[model samples]
Target: MDTACGKEYECMLRITEEILLLILDTEQGNIRVSLPAHTRDIVIAGAVLMDLAMEDRIDTDLQQLILVNPIPLGDDFLDPTLADIANATDTHDTAYWIARTAERGEQIRQRAINRLAARGILETEGHGPVFFSRLVSRIRRYPSVDGTDMEDVHVRIMRVLFSQDIPDPRDALIVSLAASCGVFDSLLSGEERAQVRDRIDQVARLDLIGRTVAAALRQHTPSARSRKSARPHQQIPCVAGWPIAGHAFAMSRDLRIFLTRQYQRHGPIFRIKAFNRRFIVLAGPEANVFVTKAEHVHLRSNELWRDFDAATGSGRTVMSMDGPEHMRMRKVQAAGYSSKVIQNRLDDVIDITRRAIDTWPMDQAMSGFPALQRIVAEQIGLLLTSLSPQPYINDLTVFLETLLKIQVVHQWPKLMMHWPRFRQARRRVMELYAALLVAHQPENRRHRHSDFIDDLLELHRTDPQFLPETDLPVAFLGSYFAGLDTSASVCAFMLHVLLKHPELLARMTAEVDALFDRGTPTAQGLSELDVTHRIALETLRMYPIIPGLTRTVSNSFEFGGYLVPAGAQVIIGNTVAHHLPACFPHPERFDIDRYQRGRAEHRKPGAFAPFGVGRHRCLGSGFAEVQIAVTMATIVRETELVLERPHRPIDIKQMPLPHPAASFKIRQVRRRRASGTV
Candidate 1:
């Protein structure tokens, strides 16, 4: 090795870093040279190609690597590689060069290692293992600085990848190369992997050199070529269903059972033909992490909910927005559900719950779902608009139900909206919203800082351009739609579960009793009700309101050994994932203690996604939890309740939001002791 050439290589540290990253597993503190001999060679060769592209020595546009500048820099490693490309008599593409150069991957790896050792960045040691009268030599490499043990350089590479700050092109290329080769799994911890997984995806999209290298590798590798030849949609195992109509009926009948069966047969990633369309279903925690944590650039939320546009109103709501637009709207809307705001409104929530409870016909057995629905609607109405639920609650409920039914139909025919009931209900709901908007104007101010509507109005006042007068009603409608059915269903599920299990109910009652005994039902008091909180979490796990979250892929990506193409509708089944034995053992058993300190089953990433996850995690999560806790605690403290039909199971309809298949009837036994006594 020439000392002058090694000195010249110091200026091209980017190439050295890329080679080191490829040949060394910084996380494991070992050289990856022992793997398939060609792996390191191919990656090093790919890095050289990337450096060439970056240096403008070569250019690529969709096909062949066109050499523009044949003149090479003085660096020994890069110059020789450049000569191979520049002096070739035969016209070869990028893939050909990578393959030809990769033949000497081992030589390249040894030279890079020797150079790093010469620079004192790495220490090499030789050891021999005696095997059957023969000695096998093993070379071990470790990071060293000035002959002292030092941290691996890969950590800095990962830090650059994970940091919010943009990395230089060289650092980006190195990280992108590792990610594109799927080396991250061996280099990152499970938690760290989850954190940087999306970031890696983002980097892959940004790094042209890395993508070019990946494309070249795919073209060269036989297996990768086969995979590329097969269409992404054809790769996934589609669940057996009807020819054209597909699994629409089965899906509607019981989505959880249908999906679970498909998951069992086809593994975590599968496709189901339903409503004359193919939906790629991704189950379990890994899928959840992929879908939720994926960059918005790759997976978009807007297209998934296109059917709901008419019902949700044009671009007026946050559901239609994505990326920065969604973030801005969420920031403004989040103010209403912030911890401070929710605490201040605790009294309002409890008062509305108490009033609704007072109205429930106590002695006679009555439907639990409708009563809970009305109560939650009223509570949300008060919290959002500071308005009574009197005339509008029924209309709002009717509107939501009609819209949900239409949504389930999946075919958004224009004629369906012309139906009498659907039209009437939608008209009634719009009229109510219009009335509310009229009453909430600046001139019609009664209680200026009363509720969520007031907050929106205030924002509109502050930034007229951002929150136009036309959008105020849309924002209110969006919040109403987001909060109403989901919260009500969760509260109803809690009641249904408690009524069925007397022991859990007794435990919760005792816990709530103890909580109020400490002080009045303040926000501070409610936060301390651990058992009550656990019950809420457990119910959400058992019956996730949304069941599954859907998104449309905007960029092609690999998942579970299959290429998921762009424009595919991907379903991350929260209900399916929640019930997985791997995620939550004995998942069917409704046990609140699963969430307790010693047994925090919900702590697992993606194990519990009742409110969805990532950028679009339910904005009203805090408000919903507070509302459910206050409602359940109040019920447990004020009344004694029993299941109306003990033998009958709670018939749950898992769509638009999980609700009872039929009304759940519960009988009130008697009034409980005062708040002070358990």
Candidate 2:
């Protein structure tokens, strides 16, 4: 080969790289499983042989593989196989060399991945999932679920398969290699595969190396039953069930503890059937990594939340949508839901928090969770929706939690929606929504600064099809609900931890006092509450607000050698890793230092997913953190609260969501200073 031509070949993606990329399910970070196991290995081996032939190191005809130039290419993926072929004492056909090379498949696969990562074609963020990209820069591109911008191989292959253009020898060889391995099964849908099958066959016949690869793979292909039997003889363990209740009773008793026990016993992946709804439970750090890397391709959220969508009376909410549509909707509200939104209005938030604290009767015990929730609801309204939640807080709470209990958790009967109190609450909340809609219309908002509602209103006006008028009420209410509930839960938990650890409380108090001494807490000042920040993170690690997420498998994938097939319901125990001693040393202990620079345990891959993971990962996570820290700081600087008299240990109550039991109360010992005096 001419020197220039050889350099050109060097610049081009190698046949091995092309084959690996072709078979990779980029969205899932796994080789496509549409074909049986080890097919890619054979195809990749054929690629190595073909590359050798092209380089004049070997030649192949219908009957025999002939060594031409015995010199090695020095390519890691090809050199070993080439040397074997060169040193062979006896001659053999191409099929013999292909099978022998296939034995090195795992090593070949790893080398290709390492090369890809080195080339910047693939990237890894920290210890997170391998990310695929076609873009040249280092920016992270999370490809859309349906498909991403087609990489060069995909684009090239599709162009050749669908058109009348004559194929290049290299293209023809790739087509044959892919055809032999059934890669088209995944790269194309059924209709597309049928359309291109004849063309593929014609192209496969055009290259002698391709034809030999095809014949060999066809002869070696395992039968369907044998292939099924060949899969690893392992099954995900199932939790013990009780008659018709399945594992429902145990899950209801305390899901976090139950799941933690299951993780301890069965490791990360297991099965639990509850109320005729069987779920494949994925727990611990490893499962988090798997889901984070593959969720966009292998899981869908709409199915799991369909009942909640129906209960909303609106067609769909952002929480229930997936793929590009979900992304589009999330973009619509992204700015409004950001921490910057909360940060920009820190004073208003602090004011609302202070006012709520002032309402507590002096020296009297109050329900901690509900009291904190009410305060958060008020702050969420003023800052997010420009409404006062005081009049409608009870109504919003009752209406939202009732629907969540019935529709999301399946804790109550559908008939619970019609109970008189629920009906009253629902009616009041609808009225509240209606009022918000009217108040936020373009004309009515002349003087008011834009909030989340304004963003929705503008979108509804501009793109009715995208954000229809009918969806506004539910969207508005849902956004409000998101801010109110989780933030309060985190705040309550942070408070509990602070009270339990008086030394930590003292440290936090000292930190807050220092912060307040810097004048009114600016976003910059609030952000610098390092000790307080660690406390908040540690609290979240110990008592994650949303313990786990429910999803439905949209595509079949193997986890720990067990096939979690398509259409299975899954419970992602995302926060379970937080409690694992492997992920966090002495996890039950409230040690804020775990987040310190020396430890930094949460920085480990999938070790800390308090906001869950992947596409549906909590977008408001940053906002929640700031809101919690700010609230905790404000409370510490303003009032002295102690565990209520006849102190009872914290007990979690799970229904709509996990929160400290009603008996968990706090009494205000005294006002440390007048509200806002700090």
Candidate 3:
């Protein structure tokens, strides 16, 4: 075909776009799971080459590729490959160009998807939330914006495959590309494929470009065994354990201990099986840096939290979204959940802490975790929405903990979500949020201080499509729960550590008393509490509440000489650095001075990640830290904490979130500062 003549046969979707549409599982919105991810890249590269051929920019015979015209296509995806072929001085075969282009498979795929999204034919959206469905939310979905049942390329391809009608040259190329990548294996079953076998081969021969693609891919595509042996990337080492159970029992017994041991034994990356599911663990300081760098590109978190999103009745949460949607929601809630919010309202936070402390019976052996949880919940209420959560603390705790266990942890049965206790707790928590919504109304809070809820309401008013009223509960509740679980547990651990070591406790006490000795605790003054700050840092490092992040590999990446492939479910062991002696000397010891100026072990990249790492690194890390520091300072300054059983070892409850066990009780033996005093 001549170059000018080929331009007359332009189709609705580009060859690359048509190939994408055909290979994509319409229901899931990602490339079909049955197709290897790399193969998708190779197919896309081939599509670019096919488009170039259609434009008469290039031509291929049985083996060698001939560059007829060196001109650009003006299309982003096609132009780059056209330029690459034009720039080459030496002659190369079709397989050479395909391999060269496919080397940038991730970039090519993303660019094609981005262009498709920009054209408005397809919209990028998350799996909103299904009640009990197994979610693969990690991969993105692109449903047609028109809401029509018929997908043009898919319908057209099937029409050609199942019938005797001849396919157009474009459709023939798509058929060839799909077959070359084994996409037919996923789209058509063995029986269906068997029926279409002769037709597919017949259609694939219609275009010379299609025949070239078929031949190049057949000759160059390595078998699974050859690819494994040829490439330096080895299989991730799996932790030795039983067939089905794997390390579930060991992990359930003590997660931190098991993870630390694995890091030491297996080095950075390894795999583990829990029940029927397998997870690859990326550990140590290097893994932390790798995750921080790769999070937005290669890893994602929304798929892991879809059940939690559904259980919240919000359909989606900021934590359960990726790409643009996640960023938009995160930006709306950023200022409201920041540490500056706590810094501005230091007096209110201190007052809330003091009042909660006063409620603790003076000489009674009260449970540490629950007591601290209630106090943190109260502070979150006052600071976040300017509404007290005091009455609904128990209800909120029950509701959040139950959903976490059932949805996030997968420890409890999903049916537990329907239990009456959870039902009532959820109702009460909703009532609390309902009250918050009412309290933040413009007329109701005319003179009241604007808060996180007010910001959410403002965003909803401006962009309801993005921040719908239905999602308000999760928007508010997400921030509250983050504090309730992570910040509260850190405070409990601080209490445990302080109670365990009298000298450290006394040093923290003196630091707190000195901070209060100055008029009011300014953010500057709170930040300067070196001993107290180190204790908080040391506590977080020693007792990380959320140890590792569970994510799906969005793009295949190489780490420590092993290739972590796309579509893998992985646990990035972010806290592995905290326990590694290389990152911190004598990591097991309770040494607050590791964070001191001279040592500053936590200053290293990936060495200290109590707030997690990467783009999803907790937005409220500053808030959590200040909350812990101030709460610890207030408690130490006001009353003395004595462990109920001083000699008993601190028992850890590791499921859902790790925290000091209820048996780790503390009683206030001395009151240095009265509840109502300055």
Per TM-score, the best of the predicted structures is 2
Q: What would the per-residue lDDT of candidate 1 be over residues 1-678, giving only the tens digit for each residue?
A: 001123333344446444564455332233442333345567777877776676667876447878878987765666777888888887777889888777666556556655665554543321100011011012222333334332344655766767877765666767777665656665666899888778887766666776777778766672343443434668688778887779888887777767767776778898887766778988877776665535354566787555556555544457656666665666566667655665777766666766666666767889888788777777776667766555766667666666666653363455676778777777777787877777777777755775678777777889887777666665776666766678878888899888888888888888888876765578888888887888899899887787676778888877788888898888776667778787788988887888877878877766777887655668788778888888888888888888888889888875556687555888887777543333
lDDT tens digits, residues 1-678, model 3? 423234343424467876776776544345665676668778888888887887788889766999989877677778888888888899899988888898777667667667666655443421111011112122222333343222467778899999998777677888988887788998898999999999998888777778887789777664432433222334677789977888888878877678889999988888898998788888888988776645766888888889887777677777887765765666566668778899998998899888888888878889999888888988888888888887888888788889888988788999898899999999998998899887887788887777888888998899898777788887877767887788999999999898889999888888788889986799999988999998888999999987878998898877766888888898878888898888899988989879778999997867988777765778777778899999989988888889999999899888778888879899988788876986
Tell how far residue 386 is off in model 1, in angstroms. Answer: 1.6
Q: Estimate each model's TM-score.
A: 0.65, 0.71, 0.67
Report the Cα lDDT for residue 205, model 2.
87
Give lDDT tens digits, candidate 2, residues 1-678.
211126556666678877887787655445664644567677788788878877778877657888888877878988998899889999988778878898887678768777777776764322233446446233433222234432467777888999989988788888988887778887898999989889998988887767766776666542432433323313678788888889898888877778888999988888888877889899888888887767877898998678887777777888888866775676667667778899998888888889888999888888999899888888888778888878888888888888888898898999988899999998898899888987887788898888888888888889989877667778888766775568888888888888878899899899889988888899999878999999989988888877888999898887865888888899999888888899999988888889889999998878998888877888677777888989889999999998884455788877777778888899899998886576
**Which of the two, 1 or 2, has more lDDT?**
2
Better of 2 and 3 by TM-score: 2
For all predictions, the C-alpha RMSD in Å is 16.5, 8.3, 12.2
Better of 1 and 3 by lDDT: 3
- Give lDDT per model, in order: 0.69, 0.79, 0.79
In model 3, state the lDDT of residue 648.
90
Ranking by TM-score: 2, 3, 1
Candidate 3: regions farther than 4 A off: 1-234
